[model samples]
Target: MSSKRMATIMGVTYGIAAIMPFFVGDIRFIMHILIMCLIWAVVASCWDLIMGFAGIFSFGQVAFFVIGAYTSAILSVQWNVPSVVAILLAGVFTAGMGVIVGLPCLKLAGPYVALVTFGVHMTLMPVLRGEIGIALGSGGSQGILTIPPVNILGYTFSSANQIPTFYFTLFLSVVCTVIILAVIKSYWGTAFLALKDSEEFAMSLGVSAFKYKLMVFALTSFLTGVMGAFYGHYIGMLSTRMLELDLFCTLMVMLVVGGIGRFPGAILGAFITVTANELLAPLGAYRAVTLGALVVLLVLLLPNGVMGLWLKRSDAEA
Candidate 1:
């Protein structure tokens, strides 16, 4: 099958999966897991835009995620802004910060860039922990509680009815996927690939590496920030734990396990990692060991990820 056809099938399959929980009946816990998967999928996709396509190794993309979540949480809980409005504002705020961070760091290359971005992510934890006078309404280690739930057109998503929130997250996921896909398939995406493959060559061909890099940073950060806002509202609380290194590591693993630069890799990796984590939860302390082993095996064996395996099969058949 052609790549386009495969992508279409994958998209349709994911859409169906998104709504499958509603038909499964009374398995709210599973539905919750699916919802989380969709959220991470969105985040991983955004991360791919910068790291995979743009060739920027950003270890701290989660900083934008945290910024977005806290921005929305503070706006809704402290300023009494509407949930939807706060989310939008959060996207804008995070994108602006992305520019601030990218401007300085994008000029650097290799491990230095990664280190700077990682530093930025670490530095935000203290601020979010209220080291800065209740910054973003966070109560230090206590965190923020009673975050307003997402309300849309008189319908509020609460613990009793998780279905609405699931659908809401699914809708946002679709939107994010479409937007990122569109950007990736555009001329700008070509520039990103060229920059990634060979920066000097791309510049020789009239592509501006700095410009595209900055754009990707701001754009991906906005999308991630929007998802973070949804997450804050959906969970009905916020804490520095949400911005932990473990979560960042999980996002990286998803990208690696899903096939890095491949578009579907983000979603596939997110599903696999999240599902695997949940399933291994019953394994007690050994869960981490098992999960780490699985990841190591996949990396060593598959290299490009599960999506890469599929592509390899397709090529062999063709």
Candidate 2:
């Protein structure tokens, strides 16, 4: 679809989501699902930048996520800064760290990059707890609480009103999606894909492999950091444990099930996975079993995720 048409469709979808609570009697539940899905959708999209587009799979993304969340929380709580400023700064901070991490870590690809990221996560887990965290007032093991919700203009958004939080997240998510799509459609994105296929070949074609790799990493890190910051505010907390391996694994599963190289695949994966988690919440003990079954089914059946299947059918029809 053309960019204009795409924007219109997204705008309509977001409008529906933003006002969905009013139609549904259970505003809390609706908001919960929308907010959660939006957050993960952004994260999943950022994952697409490294793993999906660039073909660099790094598991330690959550570490940068935690950094963004903690940084925004600390700044808001201690310095009394606006969430917007905090989010922007968090992106910058995370992007800077991405360079530090990417330079040495990007040197290793495939499973090696994933291992390095896992190691990074393992190293950060301890430092984010108790006294060490207390020095930074991160609440460490206990996690930080009473985090301030986003305040825009004269309006304040707390956990009480779902509209503001839902809209805010939706806006950020859409913005991230647009930014990513734009980048991917550009020569820079072409460079990323080139490197993914063959770094040496990309360099030979006048594409600066190092430059594009670093750029993509920085861009992905910035978006991930923003996701973390918004998540911290919306959830009203932050912790080291929340940035666990299990979470990344689940995210990776979502991406793989969604279709790694495709944009729509990543989003469709987030939506389906989030919806499944919510719908199965009532199942309690059986929820995990159900989710596993669904994943297995999707892998064997869809294989390329819902969007991937749709695309294939479309192509076949054409």
Best by TM-score: 1
lDDT (0 to 1) per candidate: 0.84, 0.77
Off by over 4 Å in 2: 1-16, 312-318
Candidate 1 wrong stretches, greater than 4 Å: 1-6, 133-135, 312-318
In candidate 1, position 143 carries an lDDT of 75
Residue-level lDDT tens digits of model 2 in 1-318: 234543554465556666676776266876787887778777887887788788887776788888889988988987888987887898899899888788876578689988887777787778878577789878768888878887878676656777777777788888898888788878877888888988888888898867887897799889999899888887788878776666776677668677777664676577778887778999999987888888888878866665455454653232
